[model samples]
Each structure stands twice: as structure tokens, then as C-alpha cells.
Target: MKDQTIEDWSREDLKNQWLCWIDTIDPKVSLKEGDSVVFPKKRIVVQAEMTPLVKSIFARWERLSPSERFSAWEQLKEATKEAMKDVLPSCIQCGECCRKGSPVLRVEDLELLRTEKIPWSALYTIRSGEPVTSHDKGEVFFLVDERIKFREKEGSRECLFLDSTSSLCTIYEDRPLECRAQACWDQSGYLELENQPYLTRRDLFSHIEVLWDIIEAHRSRCGFERLYGLVKKLKESTAQREAEEIASKIIDLTSYESHFRSFMAEQLNIPFDILDLVFGRPLERLLELFGYRIRIEKDTKFIEIITQEGPFHEEA
Candidate 1:
């Protein structure tokens, strides 16, 4: 769920969830023996005696105004930070955080993108699925699933926009909100406190508190859905020339499909002859031969292919 929707949850419910999560980690609480809690690289036996009280405070926090809420959240986060100082591990800069499959844009991000004069086609392209347009508001943006997939699969499991060679963002200043809000195990300063076992618990709690604060803020903002709507609207309202220009940037269909077929065949270690029988020939013939199906709408610039994995591509 988007942060905005999260914000809509009753304060009490949110608090209860938070408490439940913490309780799962408490050593003093009832936990099955041999049960383990996993962190990035560490797993610890469930202790039966520690109970951290964050949910109660969080519940009381909901009645505050946005500014006040943020402030309170920050304070709580600081406390957690102080407590968990010792157990946090340092990041090895594996670049997993910048991976491509995570969706970072929200409505505000899309609106901001519009302020620039770059043609939408040159700036972004729809992949994996059709652009979703808001029927009511006419906003358009990339779908969340697409964004997630892009982040997950593109550029070696890092973000496509992340420059691996330089360890920099291609769109640093314009990166999405989710990207900006991200903090992994190392960013919270817990690694520096790793030697301080007495402070480990506090530090871990603080890290989580900070994370939840961001989540709550996002829920309140409804940023994710807004971005989707914006992207959809843009696609719908794009000028014909602009749309064509964008379409031109996409890999030509013949080349893309050929390459895709070859790649898939190679990945699966299937023979090229079988691949041709599966994906080659006229659309109807291909469908009849191996249940391969394609649908191309009249006047649309792409073709949709139905495969065992569902509709795989809509390429120009």
C-alpha cells in the first residue's frame, strides 16, 4: 500500500501493528525455542525477556498535525538509533539498494517531470504493461508493477538509472521519492555502534522507527497512486508527434522480438528450432502451433503476446 493509504489507517491499528512487530523480536516474550530472527547477514536466537514499547507512543502520535507528527516520529527514531548502535552492519556498497525493480515515483514525481520540456516519449516508455490512465482525473504514469520490475531486473539488479561504473545516479536530482527515502542497514549509523552491545537493541529499534516514519509519511501523502495517475494522464494527453517520437525510440518490433526469442531460448537452453516453432510464423499460425497468441489493436503501435507466463510484451 502507498504511504498515503497507510496514513489513513486508524492510529490505534497502526500502533497495534507496530507493537506486534516489536513483540516478535522481544526476548522476554513467548517464542518457540530455536526460532531465529534474521537480519541482513545475522540471525539471533529468540530471547524471551525484552519488550520494547514503541506502539503505544506511536498510537498517541496520530492525533498530531503533520508537522508535529513528523517531529514526534523523528524523536522516536533518534531513540531507536541510540539503542541499536552496536548490531548494525556496515554496507559493503554492493549497490543492491539502487537496483532497478523498486518503484520510486509517486504522483508528485510525475507532476514534477511534466515541468520539463523533454518529450514524454524520450523521457520514459511503457514496458511490461499498458499505461494506466485515470478515467476520472486523466492522470497517467508508469504502473507500479512496471516500476518494480524495472528496478528489479534492469542494470544488474540495481536501478537502470544508477551508473554502476561511477556509483552515481543518472537522474540524481530528479530521482523518485522512494529512492530518496531508502535507507538500508548501514545508513542508520548502527554499524559504527556495533561494538557497543548494550546499545544494540536501541540502535535497531531506532532504525526501524525511522523507517516507519517514512512509511507513515508516504501513507499520508498518497504519493504512489498520484504518480501512477500522472503518468497515465501524460500518456493519454501526449501530442501525436511526441508519442511517435517516443515510439521511435523503442527497439523496432522485428529486432526486439528476434532478440527476445534468442535470449529466452538461450536462457532456457532450448533449441532455436523449437523457439521458431513457438514464436515464429504469422500470428495466427504461431498461436495454432504452440498456443502462442498475439493481439494487435487497430491503430495501436504495439502487439501483445500471450504466453504461458501471461502477456509478455507489447512492443512497438
Candidate 2:
């Protein structure tokens, strides 16, 4: 077969090519002579940097004229819908889809989740700061919005609803619209995915914005951004006493806990585990970056933020 240039390709061809490029490396997919692709087998890692070539492709789309863009979209949508008309694709039950990642739950799916078959524990939220691959932009970054999604197995990429032995959905009948929209035989299902409505933090937490506003206010006042500078200064100081004093002043654990607990309980009205994901784990990890280990004693409700090499204080 003769190699076809991207300039000669139709909009639908480009869309399908982009899909395959992101999904997996396949020889069947069309590409320029030297296009390099990365196939991430797990959830999109936040740290992956976009190459200049990928950035250029994104810029090209942004510069498209209205009429030119409309023509392209029309072709893209018609091709996707047409993939379903001829014959419904057959599923060999390979379980690749489940292994790739769990589906993001739609708002309508949240309503059905009230049923006994689908417990709330089976879900997980990818909050605003979590990273996910953008199907359109082909880049990964901290998401601008909170997304409710089905949980994956504890240490595996397979969806929680997928039965390992059978390669079938445990909650097949009660699966979300996103799951229903996927078809093993056709790429169209994945292409048309943006049409589905996703559930956000605001849908479940009525006053989350209030908590966010307070958190933002605290962030501005707290100087969390200066953490790295404090760490660097501590590393350079000759006196251990001075370093300890600086560390204590830099991390106001008391102030953070008091304000955070108040905002979580009174303002946000969210569960404790939600707070752990949204604030606790992140804060703990941040401290770890500065050579501190955080240990929470559940029995006595104590928090110990200690240095890796020296004596530390405990709080209750």
C-alpha cells in the first residue's frame, strides 16, 4: 500500500489516527514518517511532558476557521455514527477495555447508583488536582474539574466491576452509560464519548465551592508556595536548632488542622475520607518532599509529623 500524507487525509482519518496513536501503537494506524508515540498502559501520569510536535498539532486545531472547522466536525461525527449502523460489533471478551481504565460516571449513572447492586464504595472521584489524559488535547495535566468515576481494583488497572476470571462485568446490567457506549469492535463508541454528561464534585457536595473559597483564601495567606524555599534554607543552615525553629514556623500544623477541620465539617459537610483524599494525603506527601514522615495514630487521634533524622513532637 502507498503511504498517504497527513495533508491528503480527511478530518475523520485524522481523528481515527489520533485515537489509535493514543490508545496503542498499531502498524495499521496512519502517521507521518517519523511520528513518535507513547503508549501509557495505566492512568495518565501527571508528570508526562508533551513534545513540541504534539503541541504544534494542538495549535493547528486552535487556529482552524469556523467554516473549515464545521466541515471537519461534520465529517468526523458522521463517520463515528456510521461505524454503528452496518452491524453491531462483536465482543470477544478480551477485557482490554476494563484493563485500560474504569469509566467516568455520568450524572444519570449516579441516580442508579442508589440501588443495592451498586454501592457507593465502588466509586472513586478524580478530584480537580488529579491528572487525566485529555482525549482532544493529547496532554495530561491536573484536571480543572472533579470527575466521579468507577473504582479500579486496589493494585490493578482493571475496573472494579470486571470479574477477573470470567472477563465480564459483575454489574453488567447496572453499568454506567459510559460503559454502555463502549464497543470492542468499533472505534466510534470511544469517539462519541464526549457527548456523555459527567458527574462533578458540585453535584454531590452542595457547598463544596464554599470550602474551596476558604481553602484558596488560606493558601494565599499560608505561603505554602514558599515551602521549597524554606526547605532549601534549612539544608544550607549550619545550626540544627535554627533549622528546627524554621521548620516549626514554616509548617503551622495547628493552624492548618483547626482551619481545615472547621472548613470540612461546617462548610463543606463532607465525609472524613473525602477530606483525606482532598487534603490529608496531599499535605502529608508535600511534607514528605521536605524529608518529613507523617504518621497518624487512629486510636488516640494523634498526628506525628517527624523528621527522618531527629526527634520530633506529636500532636493530639
TM-score of each: 0.26, 0.47
Give candidate 1 regions above 4 Å deviation. Answer: 1-94, 100-104, 114-158, 186-307, 310-316
Worst 10 residues of 1 by lDDT: 42-51
Clashes of each: 47, 0
Top candidate (TM-score): 2
Candidate 1 residue-wise lDDT, 1-316, digit = tens: 2455434646755544444545454322112365332232111111111114244445566676666666655554444433333333433333445642333234435544457521222222232233444312335533433221222332244555666675566666666554554434322342333232221112222355643453244233333333233333434545867545433323143334445556655755646533322232222222222223334568444423333332222111
- The alpha-carbon RMSD values of the candidates against the true structure, listed in the order shown, are 22.3, 16.6
lDDT of 2 by residue, 173-267 (tens): 78887778765444466668677667764565446677666545544544334444555676677997887776665555534654665565665
Candidate-wise lDDT, in order: 0.38, 0.52
Report lDDT (Cα) of residue 284, candidate 2: 35
